[model samples]
Structures are given as C-alpha cells and as structure tokens.
Target: MARNKFDVDENLEVQFNFGHLKRMMGYVKPYKKEMIITLVLMIIANAAGLLSPYLMKEAIDSKIPQSDKMGLVVLSLIILATLVISGVCMKFRIRTMARVGQCVLENIRRDLFVHLQKLPFTYYDSRPHGKILVRVVNYVNSLSDLLSNGLINLITDFISLFIALGFMLAINVKLTLISMIGIPVLFAVILALKNVQRKAFQALSNKQSNMNAYIHESITGIKVTQSFAREDKNLDIFREVSGEYRSSWMKAVAIQFLIWPSVENISTLTIALVYIAGVYSLDKTITVGVLVAFIGYIGRFWMPIINIGNFYNAIITAMSYLERIFETLDEVPEVADMPGAVEMPEIKGDVEFKDVHFKYDDDKEILKGINQRIKAGSTIALVGPTGAGKTTVINLLSRFYDVSSGEVYIDGIDVREVTLSSLRKQMGVMLQDTFLFSGTVLDNIRYGKLDATDEEVIAAAKAVRAHEFIMELPQGYNTEVNERGTRLSVGQRQLISFARALLADPKILILDEATSSIDTKTEITLQKGLETLLKGRTSFIIAHRLSTIKNADKILYIKDGIITEEGSHEELMAKGGDYNHLYNSQFIMLKAV
Candidate 1:
C-alpha cells in the first residue's frame, strides 16, 4: 500500500547507463535518412564556419601588407559568403532536425501507450496513476531533443573539433600544443562531476514524477476533498511535493550551470597562454597574421568542446527519463494470451468453476477451493458481506485474473485456452462504479458494440429503461456528457451502463451491484427491462437488495472465501442458515422503514 502512494518514488537509484542510449537508437532508426541529411547540413555549416578565420588570416598577412586592395576586397567577400552559407545551412539543419524530433516523439509515445493497454489491473493497482502518466507524457517528451538533435550534435562537434585542431597544428605546432594545455584539466573537471550530475538529475526526475502524481490524484479526488473539507490538508501536501520538486530542480540546474562557466574560463585561460607564448616567439618564421589566425583557431577548437559538454549534460538528463520510459516499456503484461491460443467459439452461457483457489499479490486467499456449475441460460444470484469473495468469483469467470488453482470452463472449454478478446467479447460485465467516457449519450451506449447502429443503440436504451431519462435531456440520445457522466445522477449513470451492456447482447452477463444506485421506483421499472435483457442469457447478479435476487434460479450466500449456502429464495428460507438471516435482516429493516 505504501508503494501505491503518490509521494513514493518508484525508482530512486537510477545509475547512469549507456544501455539506455543504445536502446534509444532503435527509435532513431526509422528517421535515419532525415538525420543523415541533417548531419550533412551540419558538416557543411561547420566547414563554412572554419573558413572564416583562415580567410581573415590571408587578408591580414598577404593582401593588406602588399597594399593589394582587390585582394582584400575579394577576401572580405569570401568571408561574407562563408557566413551566409553557414547561416543557411544552420537554418535548414535546425528545421529538419525539429521534424525528426517530433516524429520520434510520436513513435515513442505511441509505443508506450500501446504497451500500457496490454498491462493488467494489478499493474495499475500497485502504483500511483500519476507516476505512470508522467512516464508516458513527461518522460517520453524529454527524449525528443536527445533523439533528434543530441546524437547529431555529439557526432558533428567531434568532427568540428578535429577539423579545427588540424588547422591549428598546420599553422604552428608549438602554439597548437600550448593551446591544448586546458584539455586534460577540462576532462578531469567533467569526469569528477559526471556521477554527481547523473545522480542529481535522477533525483530531479523522481521528484517531478512524485509532484505530478500528487497533482493528478488531487484533481481526481477534488470532490471528495471538498466534501470532507480536506482542501487545506491537500494543499499542504501539494506544497510539500512541489517544494521538493523545486529544490531538486535547483540542485540539478546548479550542477548544470557549473559546466558552461568552467569551459569558458578554461578557453579564456588557454587563449591568454597562446597569446603570451606567440608574443615571445614572434619572428620571421611565425608572422603576426599566423598568430592571430591560430588564436582564432583556438577559439574554434574550444567551441566544439563547449558544445559537447552541453550535449553531455543533455544526455545525463535524458538518461534519467529514459530509464523510466524503458522501464514501463519492459513491463511484461501479467495477463496475456497464451501462445497458439485459439479464438473462443460462440458462447452458449455454460460456466463452471472447478475447485478454484485465488489470492492477490501473496495476500490471504480471496477465493478458496470453490466449486460451482451453472446450466446454460440460468440466472445465479451471489449474496455476501463486503470482502466475502462474491466479486472475485465473477472476476475469475471473466478471466480478469488467472486462478491460483483449478479451472474455469465456459461452454466446456477452458477459458485460459482461448484468446482474451474473443472470450471477453462474448460476456458483458457491469461493475458497481459505472464510468462513462466523454461523449454523447448515443455514443456511450454504442461503445459496448462499436459497429452498433443508431436504432440498435436506441432499442438497448429502451430495453434498459434509460431512454425516458435520456429523452428528457436537452438533445435526448444526442445529449453530450462529460467524463464519468459527472453531471448526471448516479442512477442515470448506472442506467446508461445497463444500456451499454444490453447493446453488447452478450451470451453471459455479470451485474455487480448494477442497480444499487437506482431509487426503488426506478429499480422496479428497470426490472421489467432487465427481464427482457436476461432472456436466453446466463447471468450472475450480485446485489445486497433481497428484492432483486429473490427470484433468481439459484442464490449463493458467500462468506470467508467460500459459499456457505446455496438454494432458491424459498429453499434458503427453509434452510434457516446464513442466507435466511441475511434475507430476514433486510426484511426487518424494510418493515421498520
């Protein structure tokens, strides 16, 4: 339970791993052609930039000294042309890489969402949904720059560094060697900060996820918070969570801020050293023009180093996000179709549970060695106190979770041996908490069967007695509702869910407290429609209302993970056991009312 808290860090110690970078290359593969073009543009831009310093050296050393005005004019024009070429290439490179980045973002986000759909309920139950959402949205977004621009920049910066170094060495060996004195110092500084920077960014990622999780939870539970007057308490929690995020962000940015100044300072010191050395060594052999050009080359040489340092910073941050993104991607679905699993044949509504035993996450068993069988087209009522395993039985029947032991057979075929989609498509399950997506009333009903016609939707709504209330709305069946149908009454939401279930026309129907929210008058009206809906179908109805289950073909009174009594309403009354007491208690309460 602690692990499910919004503030809990899902992962705390994410080591800097190159394997994440290697995995990112997979997303980059599809955009290889676009990236290659961007790389070519980058190389052209760098080459053009490199020519500017050399052209200046030529104008200073050869053209100006001889007073050759035409040569100087030509050199100026050549320098101007290189700047224009470099700028144009940079513009195209940036534009091309941005497109590639967006594509990579889309691909990664699509894969993550697809994987999320495959995960079982347990995966969601064990963690804060906000944490999961952050990985899908925030972490995936973080990788866009790294995949699109960072890789190319890392490569081109090295190329640029080598090209500038070669030119410097060509100008004069001694000054080039002197200019490179800062390299070892820079490497040492970066290496010393590497582990610290990675850890800081990892902490920041965790904090960001924690804050996001809290925000999502808060927003989702705002009604309850206000009802219970928990606004102040929730606000305090938010403040604490957001404060931690801000602190972590500042720490990470502080570490990142150190890199640029260090590189700039080192570059400045190296240039000063080159200038002092060239001044003393100035002679016929090494001209002033050569000295100035070599100094310019020194600036070019360190610029790539600075860029590489920035890219390194980006990689560290991206790795932190990648760790979480890949972690989610790697999560194997707890429930999946078996290899070679066949599609379920059309269901005939025969369900049998043979000595089923189940537990959730190693906790005490929720279902214990239960055995039951129901004939086709029969209605079974399950009555139990809360936590008495009534819902677990239906969950097993639907293959929501595999039984710890024994088998659930549908139409004499093992449920596990069939494809999940085919098996689930043949059944309709209406849970206690009815959730409606944001859509029109007609669309919500049609959700149960995507290909359902508008007339079919209307008929289902009428059969479930939802049509009258729906018709009262401003647009009748076309009336729009927000998420979860929050604007509608609880009873209205359940009625819409019933219409959805009926629209599916499933052979097997499981209604867990389906009418618990409806008023007695509404429930009486719905019963008629339910009778029509249940004809020729096997159904399992779970409700505490004795009136609802009194007519079921079989009544099961469940307790302590086992069925304590089973019979029709009259038979259970004659037995005078647990079911008798439960029924009489409800009867007495109604009499008192």
Candidate 2:
C-alpha cells in the first residue's frame, strides 16, 4: 500500500487577475435585466437612506424649536415612510440579486463541468481528481456571495458613502475636510495589507485542495488500509493534512480580522476629530441642528467605508477563486479536433499505424516508430511485458493522446482529422481495473448507451454471462453497485464491464487485460461469449496469459516499445523467438503453480 505524502510546503502563487474578473462578469450578460432592476432598487434604498439625515435636520431646526406639532408629525411620518421604503427596496433588491447571482453561478458551474468534459484525457492524467473537484465545487461556491450580495452591497455602500459625503460637505466643508484626512490613511493601510491577505487566502485554497486529495485517495484505498491494519497510520496522516488546512484557514481569518479593527480604529479617530470640529462650529455659521446632522452623515460615511473594506476583503478572496478557476479554464486540450474537422461517418474499423512515434516525456520514448495495419474485423492480440507499450497502442488507437509524430488512421481517415466525439462514440474500451459508478447494475450497463431500454440492458448482460449472478441479487439488474463496484466481486465487476462494452456494440473494441480478474470458469464462459462478440468488430486484446491469445488471428510480441515478433501462437512457438520464450516461461510457471 502507498502512503500519501503530507507536504503542505508548496508556495501558493496566484494573481488577482482583472481579465478573469471581466470574463466571469460575462456570465451576468444573460441576467442584465435582473441586474438593472436590482441596481434601481439599490439606488432607491440609498436615496431613502440619504433623506433620513435631512429629515432629522428639518425636525430639529424648524419643527421642534417652534413647538410646531403638525410640522414635527409630518417630518416624523416622512422619516418613518423613508425607513419603510428603504426596507422594502433592500428586501426586493436582495431577492433580485440573489436570483441573478444563482443564475450566473449555474452558468459558470455548467461551463466549468462542460469544459472539463471536453478537455483531453492528458489534462486529467496530469492533475488530481481532488484539485479538480475543489475548483468545480468549493471554489465556485465561494463566488456565490461575491456575485450576489458582495456586488449589490458594494454598489450600495459606495452610493451611500458618496451621498452622505455630499451632504457632509454641504453642511460644513471645513469639518468634512478634517474628517476626510483619515480616509487616505485607511486606504493606505488596506493597500499595504492586500498582498498579505491574498497570500493567506491562496494558502487556504491550496490547503483545501491538498486535504481533498488526501481524503479522496485514502477513501479509495480504504480496503488496502483495513487489510494491512494501517488505519492508525492513515489517521495520523489525515490529522497532519487536516491540521495544515485548519492552520491555513486561521491565517486567512487572521488577515480578515486585522482589516476590521484597523478600519474601525481609523473611523473612530475620524469621528472624534469631527466632534471637535462640530463643537468649535457651534458658535459659528453652523447651527446646532446642522452640526448634529453633519455628525450623522459623518457616521454614515465611515460605515460605508467599513462595509467597502469588508467588500474589498471579499473581492480579494473571490479573486483568488477566479484565479484558480480560470487556470483550469485556460488549459487547452492536448488532443482537440482541427478547424473544420469533419465528423466521421460509420467506421469500417481498418486501423493502421503509420510510423507512429510517441513519448509522454522527451527524456524517454514509450513507443518508437511503430508501424502496423489491421484488416477490418480482425482480432489483434498484443502480448507484451509490463511497460512495453501495449496500453499505449490502445490509447493511440482511441486517440486519447495523439502520437508525438506520425498518424493513426481508421478507415483511411486520420484519427486527428475526425471530430473526437464522432470517432470515440464508435469505440468501446474495457480495462483490467473496472470502475463502476454508484448506481444500479442496470444503470451502470446502460451507461454504455444512455438511451438503452431495460430489456436491451438485460440482453447485453445475458450476452456477457452476467445475467445469472445479477438475477441472484436482491434487485436483480436493479441492485445497486457501490462506488467502484466494491459491492460486487472482482470477477462480477469485470463481467458487468464486459456487458457494458457489449451493449455499446462498437465497431472497435479494446480490452486491456479485460479478464484478469475473472475466475477460470468465468473466463471459460467469457471466452465463449467473446467468440461471437469478436466476429465482426476489430478487437485489440492486451493479455498477459499466453493461452488467451492462442486462437487470436494474430499476436504481436512487443518488447521495449518494439514489436519483436508477430504471428499466430503456433507459428511463433515454432519460430522459437522472443514469443516462444515468453510462452514457455508462462506455461512452465502455470504448470509449477
């Protein structure tokens, strides 16, 4: 069993990309009407907020001093009416923005998922499932607030600040100027802390991705852990990973907490200065009521500043999420159709490799100048030692990773020349490691053909010799297969996968050790099924058991990325080449066992 490496020491580098923000905002285009309506409501709410202080000024200066009960009642009523209007506008604005935000979020997540699906297999090979999951799920979720409330709150806060500042300057310019001195200081402090806060959030996001990767790997290999009695060891590893995640989160929280206190202190000091100025103005041109109202407006100004600071924090955090999301979005698929790539018609399954050269890295070649041709409807068995490029051949045929040089052709059309979907839709692949989703046996088999009927699924199961065992289950075909088909025995999972492949009825079928898990009896039955299934389809079988290829139309003995020998099993055995050595060695091993 492999132990997960618990290293959280990687530097979390990220950009607060303005271009990504612009691209993200593009999702809001569909909801423009909702956005405009929400903005209008926000403006109305801010306008009401703006009028309150003026109403207070009027009551204190005109009505209360004159003992004018009617005027006081009118002003009081106007204030109360403004409060209700503001409350109503705020409530409606929140609802509208939330609706728009959720719609935008849905669009983003949909695009993320669809784009991920479209990405080439190479992209997946290079990244962890956990990291991708975090970007698709948690990171996108983080943007929900920024898209909805953060945006609306940002707009309203600025509007409130400007309107309140206008009133403050109007009431007493000197006092307003005195109060505004702290504004630059607050901004300077925020700017100084921006990078630190961003780094903290980036660390937190990275830690989250790391923790997810560890958990996913651990759970997937839980069987091995339990079998080896390594649960305590894995738990210790999990604790280390979880601790790193918590520490990163706290670092972000610490940065966030730092901002509020700093802003509050500056605002408090500014308020004291405003009070001093107000007191001196009492004997001057400013009235007591105007001074009081100015203080109210000053308080209003600082609150928005505080809110904007918080929004700024949110923006920085949201920017980190966008950075990660766009990073994945920016990845160009390694194997994508060329411009105007034609959709392949029904394939005749004539596979040809013309000088195919491939390497996952420049340092070492996995396949070297490979050349071969298979007639339509012929079965080609690839017998090779491990790491001898058998799987790479099948991968090339499927166009999962394009050959570094040269071409793979199907029915005289270059695999790269055809649209991937049109080409891949006609091929079926089964691997040694069977993977079944968490669903019914019927559902898993139907995955090969989503529109397959229940009857058709049963027919496929019967064709692959899985029908008997499936019927023994409590729900028959409806019996749920737990994740990775853990609820089923290894042989049973392979049989279901065979059923899945058989249902697809592809023109080309690639089986890489497809029967490795099957017992001898199941393999015997499967061989009988394969005799019919391989009749018209072009099949590529990568098998370690030499006996399995004895009846193959042709067997290619591959070694060190080269086909050293190719012939029927009987002919290769007579030739006494590398294939003969491999066969006899395997035969002797079987006899000894």
Candidate 3:
C-alpha cells in the first residue's frame, strides 16, 4: 500500500525489506511435503555423486597397487551403476519439484485474481491494469524458478560440498585446509557481484513491465495510432524502452560471467601454493588419488558459491512481488456491509438523498450537500453542462463509491446498511460508454441475467429494436461480437446495452446518455423501448438531448455539484429559472440539427 512507485537505482537494483520477504515465505507452505521428499532425493543424488571420487580413489590406490584386475572392473561397474541410479533419481526430483512449483504458481495466480475482484473501485481508479499485470506475471514467475530449480540446486550443492570437504579432510587434513585458502576470496567475489546481478534482474523486470504496457496500449488504440500516422514513431519509442531490457540482460550475464573464471583461477592458485608447501616437508603422504579427489571437491565448492549468489537475487525479486500480492490479498473490501447488516429490503423505488457530499479526490469535490426525494415510480431527468457532476449522482445511486458525507436511502433503508450485492441487484445501469465482451449477442444480453432464456433475450433486444438489425447479420443472436464489439457501430452497441439492462428487470434504472451516440432515427425508434424499460421503475436519465426526457416527472438542473433548480419541464419554463435559461439557450441548436 505504499504510494511510492518503483524506482530503480544507479545500479538498477530494487530493494526488498525483511517484512516483504517473510510474508513471501508463506507461499512455500502447500508444497512442504513434496519439497521435503525432493530435498531427500537431492541429498541422496548429491551424496552418491560425491561418492564417485572416493570410488575413483579406491580404484587407483588399492586396485592398481595390487593389480587386482577383476576388483578394478567391478569397482568401475559399481561406480557407473551408482551414477545411473543417481541420474534417474535426480530426474524424478526435478519432475516432482516442478509440479510443486507449478501448483504454487497456480494458486498464487488464482489468489491474486480473486483478490483483485475484491478491491475497492478507487483502487482500480488510481492504478493501471498493466502495472498490476506486470506485478502478477513477473512476481509469480520468479517464485516458479526457486520452487523448481533453485531449491534443488541449493540442496544438492550443500550436500555435495559437505561430503566432498569431509572426504578431502579425512585423507589429509593439512592439504584440505590449505586447499580451502580460496574460500574467503571466493566469498568476497560472490558478495561483490551479488548486488550487481540483483539490480540487473530488477531493471529487466521493470523494463519488461513498461514494454508490456506499451504493447497493451498500442493494441487497444491501434486505430488512433494509425489514424495519426504514428506507428513508426511508436515503434521507435518501443525500441527505446526495449533497449533498457537488452542492457539489463547484458549486465546480468556480465556479472554472472565473472564467477566461473575467478573461481577457476583461485582454485588453481590454491592447489599450486598447497603442493609447494608440501614439497618442502619431503612428505610422500599426499597420494595422487587424494589430489584428484580434492580437485573434484574444489569444482563442487565453487559452483554452489556462484549459484548461491544468483539464488539470493531470485529470492529478493520474488519476495518483492510476493509483498504486492499479499498486500492485495490482505485488502479488506471497502463496500462490505457491517457484520450485523441486513440484506436489502424489498424496495418500492422510493429514494431520498439527504445532503450527499462526494469527492473523487480529497481537494476536488464532485457532489456537494445535495438533497432530493423522488416518488416510488417517478422518472427524474438530470440536466447540466459537461463536468457538472450529474453523472456522479448516478454513480452514488448505484453505490459505486460511498459518499464522503451524507445518506442515500432506498425504500427507507440506508444503502450502506444492506449487502452490496443485494443492493445492486435491484438497480440496472447503462453507462455512456458501451462495453461488450467477446461473445454472441445472445450471450451478451444474457450477461445481465445469466439464466435468461433465449426468448427473453430476443424480447429484450426487440424492445430496444436491436433484434431486427441483429437478424440482418449472418448469424443473428449467434453472431460473434469481437473485442469491445468493434464490428458494431457505437449506437448499435448502446442498443445492446439497453437490452441488457432491460433484461435485468431492475426496480431502478440509470441511463447514462444511453442514446447519445445513436442517430435521430435510431433514437426515435428506441423511444418505445426506453419507455417500456422505464415503466414502473424509479429512473434517472442523463443526456445532452433534452427532448428525450420531455415526459419525465421532474427535471433537476444541476450545477457545481448542487441542484440549482427542480421542476417539471412546463413548471421550470414557467418559473423562468436556470432550467428555462438553458432550454432557451439550446432551442436553436435542437432545431438546426
């Protein structure tokens, strides 16, 4: 919930605190049993792997020294058999761990999705869909690597390193200690490069999010970009953004590239320095078998050292997203009713707004101290200039946002005291923007009432005069509506929306300029459908076309978030108030068009 945006450092690293990481660890719970079994297999595989060098030492020292040819063959065979078993076991471990990782990722994704639906309207208002998407994808992906490969690598490396060190020490403690002289230097090198790797990956993740946002926006607004002739410019900007991703990838590789060479050089120097020290002692205690085994252990030691460094970065990055995901999951839904609150009462369509005050943000009030009461089955027409907060009244009625101050009562029940789902069930809303998903016309109309029959869908569509036009298409109700219903005209989309709201059979209706985009013929045709849909419902209409609401029970002139005048059309004109003034101002334009 921190308001701060992600800011990459000079080294392009993102920092995660202890609290964030600790919470992320909870994701490991479900896979604990599988993880435990995989860990055991990993230890067995690594220990068996370390045993190969010991088997080699025995093959060279005893079998060769005594010239036992059969014993030598049998030892070699046993070593090969152990390796085969180890490889199969390692493969099983990989497969099992991978399943566990996938399960965790699936749960995390599901949990994030469910939590998103529970967040407040304002949470979505302030955040972009793309940023949340990046957090979900990048965060969950980081955990997948650790749960599958990182954990396995870590367990195997630790076991192998311990077994190798134990064998080397048993043979010659002095030589083993001398060989380990590079340990501190290796640690120092890994520690120095660790942040570089972390920062590089963090930068890559952020850049990728940026690229994703650009892609989403460009695709969604492809028409605008093409109409403005800016595709090439967009591509150039995208290249600039993608350039950051390429640089970060290179930086990560460069940091990791140092580990192998540096480890090899240090190990070679340590071996030479140790052999020189032993030479002066004139001791033949150091066997060739022991030296060979020590070399193998040195290889094992440096690999884990390098891997541990990289794993640190993965854990850090994964933990960052974990924090965000958990934060979302922990969010308490804002519009939830009180514990003892009741379901909505049977509404009679009577509504009262007692001094409602609202602000989209703190400093800019959108609605201020407005009071009104409407009868059970009356139609109220709201008229105002653009940005006069008329639409905000409809938003409040539907409880999209809680008023900053005031009470809105439906059927004598405070809206906040009733379950949101129950409260919303009685209201049908059609917005200024018509949104239709990718589905058939039948399905889209049925979206308002999921169990609505085919007959009902056709009825609702016919009511809105959408059925005739729909049948003119190739498949009628089954016709595929592409994304945003792009194939249909804006007015046509609005008609479908009106049908959807009509099918819901709500007690109260809100028409947010439902006919604004449609032509005159279409609007006139829809009048009967609108009237049928509005019959017996407490309705609120917001439209630029003042003529549509000429039969409304009352007209409320709203300005600066308050009701300036209220009367029927004839009454308002007779009073010669703000409503009459506005009506007179628009009379010429209404006639001309």
> How many clashes show up per model?
0, 0, 1
List the candidate numbers ranked by lDDT, top first.
Answer: 1, 2, 3
Q: Cα miss at 38, model 1 (Å)?
A: 1.1
Q: List candidate 1 stretches off by more than 4 Å.
A: 12-16
Between candidates 2 and 3, the one scoring higher on lDDT is 2
Backbone clashes counted, model 3: 1
Steric clash pairs (candidate 3): 13-199
- C-alpha lDDT (0 to 100) for residue 507 of candidate 2: 97
Go through the candidates in order and give each one's C-alpha lDDT: 0.89, 0.86, 0.79
Clashing pairs in 1: none
TM-score of each: 0.96, 0.96, 0.90
Candidate 2 clash pair list: none
Task: List ranges where model 2 is wrong by over 4 Å.
Answer: 1-14
For model 3, how does the per-residue alpha-carbon lDDT over 1-593 read when each residue is reduced to its tens digit?
Answer: 32322222212223456765555557778778887887887787777777777777787778899999999899889888889878988889878988977887888888888778767777765444565677677767767887778877776777777777888777778877887888899888877876766566666666666666667667888999999999899889888767877887687667667766777688778878766755644336767776666666656655665566566656755654555566566767766677778889777899999999998655699898989999988999999888889988988888887889999999888888888889889898888789999999888899999999999999999988888899987799999999799989998899999999999999999988887898989989989888898999999999778888888999999999999989899999999988887888788777786
lDDT of 2 at 374: 96
